[model samples]
Target: MIVSEQYGELRGRAFAIAYRMLGSVGEAEDVVQEAFLRMHQTLRGGEPIASPRAYVATLVTRLAIDQLRSARARRERYVGEWLPEPLVTGPTPAERAELADSLSLAFLVLLESLSPRQRAAFLLREVFDYPYREVAEFVGTDVDSARHLVARARTRLRDRRPRYHASREHREELARSFFAAAGQGDLRTLEALLAQDVALHADGGGKVPALGRPVTGRERVARTIAAGMTAMARFGVRLEPAEVNGEPGAMAYDARDRLVGVLGLGLADGRIRTIHSIANPDKLRHLGEVSDLGLRARAGERPGRET
Candidate 1:
């Protein structure tokens, strides 16, 4: 097939692979674009690619791996905590349901614990179903090394899997109950729905005064969320259900329809285990305007509540 046709077939898959590896949609898109650009240049210069699709995917993956190395250094210097950029595309309801677990904030956070090679190996193997040899080629590593990386990543991830294993329905239900309880200032309901060791971690990028430290204990998290909602109410901020990192979550918007913050929930055993509220101005760039969600809404929707 022609390079153009080959790119068309592989672009979406490549983008998906890069995005999962980097956890940054913008960066992933850039990596894919650059890969194609390189391919175009090579073809125009009369260099033959054995397989255009595979070549481009390999280019994108290598670029993403390098970028991840640099990003890790930058994140190490980041003020306070850092979180993945939430995917807020206006997807269909069905797409939202299908992508929720793959794009959940908690899942992405867990991925951060892996090294760049480990992440590339895991996503290529688990998400893309690339064989060990194919994954090794894409990542520019030997098959044995690739296998080891995937195994190590899996071991680390297995330890945390239980914390985020709730079904989509159960997670959404927990998110809804937590939000309603906070909105209504019902401390008892909040306490009942939250795990005793629940924690609240906010990433405001040091630009806003978020919880610089994790707020541990269910009562502490409840009080903190309640206080936050009360303060927002004082500032005329309204909370709405929104798709955050493919999971059921809330977003805070001002009277003018500008996104002010995002709320990400963590569930365990059908109870809220963690609440991540991101209000940093710098982090809101990708979120655009908060509007009526379709699949994205259902992706983050808490059931048992009136629209």
Candidate 2:
């Protein structure tokens, strides 16, 4: 069927849009499936659809905006700091470099600060490269309004937007050094690799033990990583290099080789600027067999020790 063929071609792009908009893999996949179902129904019902691709995009965008609006309340009440579900992109430096600017965890976290419509307009125009008129149509606004939405979104995000100043090889090297230092609890090396104002964010969803607030400043961030890594290493935890959210990251595995968490680092000025760790079992279920960090915490296996 023509619809089937179109679904095959458009599914990836549609999922990308939804994932970027909703920041949840399961929800994004649902949005894409629902969009295609509607498209299939419309086609079967003898409705004239000009372009299946555009129709699907519109459906996905609208669905994702609604989903995001509803998800905001839940996130506001979420336990600990909320971070996007880690998107494991594999360990490919070139691909990671290519996608870091738009697909990184930090970028998605920044997008979370915008209202649903503003997010939609900003993403449609800035990330997806849609025309102002098309963005307006997608978000149900005039071209001028769409432009204003994007401009406002840009202004809001200007201060914290991710900007990569390192090459692919440099990023790879920095990740290696940073993780190596942390794994070894080498505080001096970690401090050297971190930015002066670096911040570390972790999300546990109250299902595990994680920092309730970001640890800012190079010294504090490095110290936190050093102590946590030392404690985790005692439990036979190992950090396996991986790409997360299109950025250099690692997956932590427990003694039994079960996934304990995922870490995504955001680089700026050739230093590690942001560190995102997702240890919530609910969030790690998609990546692999998630370890029971909460149970472990209750059993006296907690991360970090007084230094």
Candidate 3:
């Protein structure tokens, strides 16, 4: 009965904020629902929120900051290579690119290094384009402190952030090639597609077998990927291509069709630069039921051996 157009406009934006901050879709949804509920309750009580957007955003920001504080502890105990839960996008891959990749696995991993306040400040000021004055108010700090928070976050992320390639078409082609090459255990093709300094990161979260450290350099990454494909083949797992976090990606499902892993790549200069694979069962839980029988069938046309 309390539905309003304003709430509709705010819903996606609020979810975006929460998702970017927490790097977990479930937590972001919960925070948004809770924030909306609180805001709705106040409205029902006849309170006047002059600036609903700012009021709601402030609430979401504070709540997300608190959640990050608590979640950080859990992450520390998490098993091998903790990657952000991948966000498998929808039908419109082209439209989802910019917004989707903003939540890219690499970016989220960088945010994890920041303190709660710094993360909140960085997201608010940079990602959301919030003014320092308002960002200060949201984080319960002065304008100067808010600026410092954002600066600190940038400093930490400067060297870590992925250099996103601009050509979406080229990147997609590169990703598909890498996926196919790795699946077919085509090391030569994989080597050609991957940069000499390519890095492979797998986040199994201690729940499954994954690399504890990043596999760096072209040769090591190529072999590691080949080995993974072999394992997937041995276990009868199949991969389906889809838009992941606004870019090309593959989802691997087990023999029972249970979602096992999601792979997203960072491409640059027409080469696969970074491979972020999330095989943590918990992380894949948000992907729901995915069947890629069609993609599996289409693979027959590609000139590569079965994985």
Candidate 2 local lDDT, 1-307, one digit each (tens): 4656766778978988999998999899899999989988998899988877778888998999999999999998998899988898863555554478889999999999899988999888888888997888777779999999999999999878887868777888999999889888889999999999999999988888889899999999999999889877776678998878877899998876789999999998889999999998888888878877556785676454222
Per-candidate total of colliding backbone pairs: 3, 0, 0
User: Residue by residue across 1-307, what tens digits does model 1's lDDT show?
Assistant: 3646655778978787788888777888889999888888998899988887689879988999999999999899988888776665455767665365566677777899999989999988876688999899998989999999999999999857434557666777788888898988999999999989887888877666577778899888888888878766765678888767666788887666877788877677778776777776666777776432222232554322223
Top candidate when judged by lDDT against the true structure: 2
Candidate 2 structure, TM-score to reference: 0.93
lDDT of 3 by residue, 1-307 (tens): 3357877888888988999899998999999999999998988899988887888899999999999999989988887777788898764555554654467777787788889999999998887889999999989999999999999989988877766656667777787788888888999998999888998998866656678899999998999999889867765778898777776788887666767778888776677778898876677767886433223433443223333
Candidate number with the higher TM-score (1 or 2): 2
With candidate 1 superimposed using the best TM-score fit, by how many Å does residue 82's alpha carbon deviate from the native? 0.9
User: Candidate 1 vs. truth: CA RMSD?
Assistant: 7.0
Q: Give the TM-score of candidate 1.
A: 0.85
TM-score of each: 0.85, 0.93, 0.88
Off by over 4 Å in 3: 1-3, 91-97, 290-307
